[model samples]
Every structure is written in C-alpha cells, then in structure tokens.
Target: MSDSILDRANKGILGLKPYEPGKPIEETQKELGIQNIIKLASNENPLGISPKALNVISTQKDLNRYPDGNATNFKQKVSEEEGIKTSMITVGNGSNDLIEFVSKCFLSEGDNAIYSQHGFAIYPLAIKSTGASAIKAKAKNWEHDLSLMKELIDKNTKVIFLASPNNPTGTVLESKKIEKFLEDIPSNVAVFVDQAYFEYLEEEKHKVSFNLVENYKNLIISRSFSKAHGLAALRLGYAVSSEEIAEFLNRVRQPFNTNSLALAAGIKAIEDKDHISSSIEINKSGLKKAEEAFNSLGFEYIDSYGNFISFDSQQDSDLSFDFFLKKGIILRSLKVYEMPNHLRVSIGLEEEMNAFIETLHDYKKALDAG
Candidate 1:
C-alpha cells in the first residue's frame, strides 16, 4: 500500500492552513545571534504563571496516574467560582480546544459561521476544519460590526463567533450591542463569545454575559487561564453554556483531554485572587505606557481595552517586523487577519515595555536615515 497520507486525509483537513504561532525567543536569539530577546507577539501574560499554580505543579505527584475523565472535581471548583452548575461547564485543553469542539459538534459543510474581519484567527480555522463555510463580516473601525454580521446570518448559519476585546485589533463589543445582537439572532444559531482575555478587563468595565446560559440557550462563553491567570503553559480553559450544549461538546471532546496538572493548575489559578488582581494592574500600567510610547513615536493605534494594542506603522508591517526583529523585539504583524499595515503587541512588564520603546525609537531613526 502507498504511504501517502495526504491523499487519504479528508478534503477539508487538506485545505486547512496550519496555525502560525509567535516566534519563540530561543529561535529568534539563535537566528539573530542576539541575547535576551523580548517577545511581545503572542498575547502572553508578562507576570508569568500565578504562584499558586506554580506551587500546585511543584507538589503534583501523579504523572503516571490517568486524569479524571469527567473532570468532576475541577468542574465543581469552576461551578463554585462562577455560580453555575457543573453540567453547564465543559473544560478544554485550552479555550481554543472548546472553539474547535463546538465547531465540530455544530457545523458542517452546508452550514455557515459568521465572524468579524479581524477577529481571532482560530474561529475561521475551527469552522473550516469542520468543512463549514465561514462568512467574514466587515469590521466597523476595527470592531465587530454586528449589523453586518446580523445581515449575513441566513437559514444555513449555525454559529457566530465574537471575540470581545478582539485579537489583533483589541476592540471590544459593548455589552448593550451584544445584548441587542443576541436578542436579534435566531434561536437555532449558536453564539460563541470568545473571552480568552476576559480577566484583564477592569471590574467596572467588565461586561461578560456568562449568565446568558440561562437566558440565551444557544450562547457559549469560552474563557482561558492563559491570559490573566498566567497559566498559558498548562493549556487550561473552559466553556460555559446550556446543559444541552455542554453535553454536545462533551460528546465530541476526548475523554481525559485535560491532564491532572492542568486541572490542578486551573483550580489553584482560579483561587488566586491576588494574582489575578496584580496581573490586571500590571496590564493597565503597561497599556498606559504603550499609549504614551505610541504618542511619542507619532504612530496611530486603535484605543485598546485589552492587554494588547494594535497600531499601524504607516509602512508595510512586514518591513516593520523585520526592522523590529533586528532590535531584539518581536511584535505580531497582522497580515493573517488581513491588516497588512498593522501590528499587535502584547503588554509587558515596565522594564520590558521601556526596552521595547527604546528599540522602537532606534528603529524609527534607522528608517529615517535609510
């Protein structure tokens, strides 16, 4: 028999574009012969993992034992924290996993999914993996244009993915706007609100609709421990939805998809109130620093509510990326989201942010000279 696996693979899988992650620090260091390169590309928490999660991992002793398939205890902890029933939650390898599982369970070749132009790249990837048609709605000033999305939703629409404080653009959909959109959408179409960066929102400004599980039967709220909780390495996240929807996701998800360490880390991370607060504070400080830096550089950026800001260098982003690479700094060029002139940079610690600003100044000068 021929060993050509590509030929045997499903058509949709074959057509899928592999996700391109942010470049690793080691890889950049090796390539450029630079030391201590700063990576602000992948919206990672600069404070690192919570001390509680780290302590849990330090004491974890069951590497040989299989994780709980149902994740009952962890679900219970999440239930207590969120004031929702365990049945309303489905844990994920990462929030990205839940997005993929939801797409698999609800979408098909005949169905369509709607998303904003510069939303997270994972939504389109997930929909396409299920052989579902993805409808790209135009953004209104880098934010989700719900009106355009609403108009695009037809009888065949099965899912609509909205990224609050959207990636690449860092524009959030207002609570009233989302509530209005949810009220207008058909009952059968599932609404997945990707709140991967949810914890970074200030308490007064946080407007997540997690309780919509009771009100909007078809709504799903996806969250992650990766961002504010700083558990990115553990790959722990979860979804909150109606019991029926949760059951469908559980059916499609693999048993023991979450390992024991990740579960422990997630539980501890959730309980670490101080860590969450500090992380948010640091992000707020970083945001202010970044805004001032942008103003000093005379670069225009979208006023961001998330831990990252998307700005245009008024030159090709690819050129800007290359220029920044040589300066031992990394930023995401959003050509993948079709914003070729823009770059999205994650907020970092004060020193790191200052270093990045200094690098930007040096690069700007070099550009002028060239």
Candidate 2:
C-alpha cells in the first residue's frame, strides 16, 4: 500500500495541533442532554451585542453587493479615535486574522517568532503555519519575562508576539518595562502586541506606548471590537502600525477580509462609549465576586487585568470541567494551555456568576467527599 496522503502535507502543518476553542452552548446541551446552559468559557461579553451596532447592522442594505474591500470608513474612524493615520490601519475578519496576516507577511521557512509561555495560542499556530520556528520564552510568575525574550532573539528572529493581559493567565506587562524591552531589541525585528483585552484594563494601567507606533516603524498594535464593544460575532478587529508595514499586511490580506456589516457595526460600536463602560463595569463586579468566592474557598487564582479569571481547580481540571458541564455550566479548561489543573471563566451577569460560584462549591465538596 502507498504511504498515507498526510505524509505529503506541509512539514510544518504535520507537527501542529489544531486549536481547541471553548465548547459552544449547543454542543454542551447535546452532549450532556441539558438545557439552560450558561457559557462562561469563551471570555465573551455576557451583556450581549451593542444596540448601536445592532442598529447599524440591521440598516445595512447592500447584502447583494460586495463589502468595501478597503474598509475605508472603519479605518478612518479608528484613525480619528486613536490619532493614527488611516494608512497605518489594516482591518481583518478578526484579531486572529490580523495575527495570521503578520505571520504571512513576515515569517518564512527557517525564520522564527518569539512569544512568551502561555501567550495566545494563535501566535504559535500562525508562525508554524508559515513553516517558521516559534520560540517560547520562560514566563515569570505567569507573565512575560521580557529580558528572557530579548535573550532569545537572534538574527533568525523575524517577529515577536507580546500579549498584554495574556490569555489563560491574564498577566499584564508594565508599560515602561515593555518600552525598555522594545528599545533594547534590534530595529529589524517586528513587534506585534496583541491588545485584545486592552479595554478591560483600568485607566491607569493603560499603555501610553500604544502611541509609540508613530515613532517605531517595526511596531504593530492589534485591537478588537469583540470584548468591550460586544462585537465578537461581527468578527471585526484591526492592526495599527507604520504605513510601510501596514501596506505589506494589506497586500497579503484578502480584499474583503472584513464584511460590510462588520464595518458598519464597528464604526457605531467604537462610538458607543456608554455601552463599553457598562460592559467594563459588569466585568469588574463579576471579577470581584468571583475572586471573593475563590478566596473563601482557598483556591489560588492569577491577578487578572482582563475580563476572565483562571483559577486552580486543585484537582483534574478536565474532570472538574465535565462536572460543571453536567450541572449545565460551561467553563474553559486550560489543558490546551498546558495547565491541566486550572480552568478559566469569563465574567457574566451577577445571577450567572452566582450560579457558577454555587456550582463550583458543590463540585469541590463532591470531590473532597469522594
């Protein structure tokens, strides 16, 4: 018999594992045969979609026509709000798409990309898809050790991915520390900072270095409307960089990477300050409540700047995850992040959080008794 066709696949892809997203509500219902499921797994905004965005999406009348390939108006809105030039902005189907665009534009065979341990999974996936090496630096206290990352950089390094308020851990890098690190690195290496959760941070913790894009030609900052703006379903996000790099990314991106509805909705979503504020407030309250519960239960949790919190299960997290599913709750297991004893839960409405807390206590007790 001939060798399997899989043997002819790209060498880089053959070694890669597919990303495991949080379980969907419908999938859980089917598997566990339970309804009334509340999903606190995907780190989505539980407050639901923004009314302004919905209004814009509903009024979108050109379904028969193609979307604006250039994403002009949305880019203009972002430029005006962020004080960046429109030429420096590149929109994508989602922030993940933007990540892939960067990889496609810069990474190649024998090249390498650097990211910290427990950084967003897409970083390595995107890099490896381009047949590039992904160098994971050792994390310090679940945060990016910038010095270690710098040491790992070599002539072969083409890009560096930094996730502030990193996923699964929610640890953020200090603004000045990141600036110093950037200054120390070689100018030839491109730096892509994934700030998907930037809006959830307190005002004081916000990075002034976002404006450094104007000065640093190699810097790119990716932002999303998915979290605070409640536009995840729209799949709208963008990257801000120097005009030169933006041109390269745009050249590699699909002409209609962002749809008409997403463009219209994103323009409205960014202007709805009240909705964003309310979302942040709800997250803050829910995070506080969850933290208090974890403390009383003697569970260890990372100090998170983002909307979700990862807590140690003190048992097999996969088993605990199954237990929660049986109880009509869906939380994220960190097995994919290589933290099998921890689970992450997104902030939801007060009642939803209460249910999660009560169910968690019950699960822990059952485990202890067993």
Candidate 3:
C-alpha cells in the first residue's frame, strides 16, 4: 500500500549512506576555478600506468564484439603468476566488484556480515546493499581487533571482511595473526580479505603468502591492479579462493564484468615486473617524505604499512581539508571512517610532496597568526 519509492527499495539500503569517494583532480579544478592540483586523495600510483599495459592498448581490436565473458586469458595469467588453478580465480570489474559478488553470493535478508569499524567503505556498501545485516566490530587504535571480531560471530553471520594494510588507517594484521584468527572463526563463514594495497606492503614484514589459501577453503583474497600497477582507469581486480567459492562467485558475476582493454592491460601489467618494482620504489621514497613532513609538524600519526598515511589534524578536519583544497593539494578526510579528526594522504611524487609540505607549513603559520 505504500507509495513511497524508498519503500520499494531494499530495507537494508534505507539505513545506508552512499559511499563517498575521494574528489577527482579535474572535478576540484572545475569547481574551484583553479589549476595545478595535486591529488593525494585516492591511493593511486603517482607513476601512472605501466609501460607494458600501455603497449597493449594499441593492440586491442574488435569493438563490435563483447569481451571474453570468462576473462580466460587474464585468469590463466593470474593462475600462472599465483601458482594456482584458473578454476580458483574470479575476475571482477574492480576489487569492489569481487566484494559485491561475494556478498550477493552468500548473503540474503536476515543474514549478517562483519567488518572492522574502520575497514574499507566498499565492504559495507557491497554487503549491506544485498539486504544483509552489516555488523561492525570495534577497532582498537584504528586497527582490526580480531578478538572483538571473533566475539561478534553468531549463527546468522555469513562473511567476515578483513583488510590488511587496511585503507585510511593503514594498519595490518600479520600473517601469523591472520592464520590464528582464521583458525578461530567458524569454517562455514566465508572470510574475504580485501588486499587492494597488497603490493605496497613491505616484503620484510607483510609475508602474505598465497599458499595460505591452500589450507583455508573459506578464505577469499581480493586484489586490485588499481593501486600498485597503475591501472585504476581500466577497472581491473580479481579474487583468489577455493574452486567451489570461485565457481559460486562467478555465477553471480556479470558476463562482461571486465572490458577487452582491461583484460589485455592486466596481462601486460602482470608481465611488467620492472614497472611494479618502480612503482613500489616511488611509494617507498614518498612515504619517507611524508614522515619527515609530518614529524616536523608534530602531527600524531598512525604507523602505516601501506602507501598512504592517516594522521590527526588536531582540529576539525573540515578546516584543514578545505585549506589543502584551496592550496591546490587534495588529500582525504576520515570523517566517514569515524575518525573525523584524521586525514589520509596518498604519497605523491617528490616535487608534489615538497609542495604539500610547504603548503602545510604555510597553513600552520596562518593558523597561528589568525
């Protein structure tokens, strides 16, 4: 009898807010009538696209035909690199698509999925939109509290999303800790690890061996080429999981979930080991630049293992966020993550970092005098 449009919409969606992404540089420039914008908002590679991927763009043909629905070649390439069978890989538009696929595959009305308090926003958007109950476990010091997460598990729970080198805060759950947590959780519940920033993690400490999946059938690992491979524009992501889980995920995935260019580019990007290395090197150097700048400002920051850093602005983030925008620097506000006083900045080029540092210094001086 209800005439309201929202009444027809999924009830769970009623309780959700739209996911707000970082503002694009072009949008900011057009809005402010300004130029020379440097964006540290999205965790994007400053190095841009891989040279190998760029090479394939010119070779792609057949605009008249649909892309490979199975993403056969791409899946085969991933299987080769990961040392897994193609049956175990699920291709997605982006890692976000993989997240949604898992959510839709397992969750329905009255079911619940769990994620950390400060976990990636896409987890909730993907899970809750399926009309499933989205549960949040309390985070300790802006990091996933696995014990608290375990305490929240109940019969209705279906999936648990874990993000290492987690977004916004950049906290990580070590492999040993992850294995222990997996051992404690119910075997029936799927655990989707969103590892979008997997390549950015330091090899010495990250230790995320893909062989972990061989032992845990319920485990699903989603990764994106957007961050480290500089392929954000192409919308390339995939999930590694048990064949049964991958089969179910594929059933719900769109036939052409990815485009022709994305498939070709993904293959090329994976082959360009040098490009991956160069991007990582730039990230490492940029992170150091951020540390020196933040330390000079006496800004209290979370120690991050990712390519970005989240720090306390020590004031309402709106003022600083807008201040940076006005100064042609674009980073992100953590208000959506429940840390309204924090801001996250993706590490940029050396010159861009220098500009950000100088602008920050100027802002402090102005704040003091005003």
Candidate 4:
C-alpha cells in the first residue's frame, strides 16, 4: 500500500475552510500587548449572564456523573413554554450542533445542500463535512433571495438552510414570505431555519419561525441561549420540529451531547425574562449609537434586526480591521463571506460602544490624513 496519509482523508475535507471565530480578548491582549480590549466581533451579549443563570453554578455538584443523555428535563421545560411536544424538541451543545446533526443524518456525497451566498460560514462547513454538495443561492442586497433558493431545489436537494436577519448582513426575510416559500416547496425537502438571534428581534418579528413549525412537518427551527439570554459560555440550544425530524436528528447526536452545566443554567436562563429584556433594550440603544456614527461617517450599512451590523469600508477592509485591532478593539472582517469591502461589529455596552465610536472616528481621520 502507498504510504500517503493524504490519500486517507475524505475529498470533501480537502477543500473545506474552517470556521473563523472572532478574536478572543485574551488572545488580543497576548498578541498585541493591549490590556484594554473591547470585542464587538462574535455578536455576544455585552451585558453578560443573568443572575438566575449565575446562581445555578454554585449549586452544580457531582462532576463525576454524566448529564441526562436524553435531555428529558430540557425537552419538558421547552415543551411547557413553546407548546411544542417534548417529542418535537432536541437539545444540543449549541444551535450549530443541531445544524450539523441534520447534515450528518441525511446528507451524502450525491446530495446537495442549499444555503444563501452570504450565509453563516458554519452552514457550508457542516454541509461539506458530511461529503454533501453545498449549493449557494445568490443573495439580494445581502438578504436571502428565496425565489432563487427555491429554483435551485431539485431531486437531490436534501436540505435548504435559511437565516432570518442573517449573520454579517442582518437582513430579515419576512414571516409571510417564509411562509409562502414554505407553501411552495415540496414536503420531501427539509428546510432548516436558524433563529439563533430570535430573542433579539422586535415583538412584531418574534414568533416568525415558531408560527410555521406546527403547519410544516418538514420544517426545523433552531434557537440558542447564546445571544439575548447571555449564556454563550454555556453553549446551550434547542431545535423544534415534527417528531419525525427530531427523531432523525437525535439518532446522529452524540450521547450526553449537552453538558450538565449548560442544561442547569439554560433552564434558569430561559426563565429570566428580565435579563433577556435588558439585553434587547441595551442592544437597541447600542445599535442606534453605531448606526448614527456610521451615518455621520457616510458609510452605507444594511438595516439590521440582529445584535450585530456590517457596513462598507471606505478603504480596504483589512486596513480598518487592523486599525481597530491595534487600538485594543476586535472587529470581524467579512472577506471570508466574499464581502471584502465590509466589516462586522457586534453591539456592545455603552462604554464599549463609546470606545468603538471614538476609534472609528480616529480611523476616519487617519483615512483623511493619508
């Protein structure tokens, strides 16, 4: 046999690019020798975890014992709240875990998975990891063009992933439009909706995904405690779908996929309405601050419903990304999403946003000086 280790790897793995997360504050401090770092890159909750969620950590005991393999309590709590049956919910380490579970369960080499052009990097990564073909439907104004996405659906289409208020761009596809799109698609093809930022949306836009799950047997809706719930560190998320879809997802999901800490904190996190409310209220204020500055600076930005925003860079995006990095700020560059001229910033606390606004102004001044 040939002694080539490369030959043993899957062909799909050869071409795949790993997901790039936002630079961590600790990493920035070590690399740049900067202590005062503010990160507006990963779309995390700037206000931090709720007191109720925090209170559970002190009570957690028996680290030697494994977590509930079936996530029974998680399903029951979610069922009580969502009016969805316990059989219809599957808990995971995070919403991304559920997304990957779906791909691994159903997709194969000949199968093709559809996603928006500017979709989350994890979508294609998960699809490709399973040796499935990833098809990109061109986006309109950085929003998913459902018509274009639907047209590409064919015999081999196993999954179509949609993101409302999609990451990076933050454009929303209306509930009615999504409903209509659901009406038009064939039942055999599964449509997975990532509503990871669901709690961050306004009252009118809330229930956009859940309202459709009951009517569509093939639909899967994913939600997270990472965003508005301020439990990103716990990495807890849940998905709602027909009992049939949840069954398949559970089959591929690893045993005890969700840790004990995430489950305990998540149960408390979901109950803390006050904490969620404050996150949204503060995010609204922070978004307004960033947008006003972007407007005054003459940068065009997509109208966003999520906790983060991306705007066009007047100069090379790399220059601006570096400019912010050197000043103890971490921002995301959208080059990986094929939008090389834009930069994404997650909404932060008042002081963090103030620092960002000041640094942004300095960058603008530097551009002018050059």
How much lDDT does candidate 1 score?
Answer: 0.88
lDDT of 2: 0.90
The clash number for model 3 is: 0
Clashing residue pairs in candidate 1 (N, C-alpha, C atoms within 3 angstroms): none
Summarize candidate 4's per-residue lDDT along 1-370 as a digit string, tens digits: 8858887788778898778899999989999998999999999999999999899977999879999988887778888888778998989898999999989987989999999999989999999888899999999878899999999999999999998778988888778888888899998888998898888777574347565778998899999889999888888898898888899999999998899888988888889989999999999999999999999998888888899999997777898899999999999999999899899999999999999999989988898899
Full-model lDDT for every candidate: 0.88, 0.90, 0.90, 0.89
Off by over 4 Å in 2: 1-4
What TM-score would each prediction reach against the true structure?
0.96, 0.98, 0.97, 0.98
Clashes per candidate, residues 3 or more apart or on different chains: 0, 0, 0, 0
Which ten residues in a row are the worst by lDDT in model 2? 202-211
Q: lDDT tens digits, residues 98-183, model 1?
A: 99989999998888999999889999899988888889999988889998999999999999999987897888877667878889
- Tens-digit lDDT track for model 2 on 1-370? 5878898777778889999888999988898888899999888899988899899888899699999999989989988898878999999898999999999999999999999888899999999999999999988888889999999999999999999878979998877777777799998999998889999888664564557887778899898888888888889999999999999999999998899999999999889999999999999999999999999988999989898999999888989898888899999999877788999999999999999999989987997899
Model 1 stretches with alpha carbons more than 4 Å out: 1-8, 203-206
> Between the candidate structures 1 and 4, which one is better when assessed by TM-score?
4
164-258 per-residue lDDT for model 3 (tens digits): 98998899988888889889999899999888999887764575666788899989998998999999989999999999999999999999999
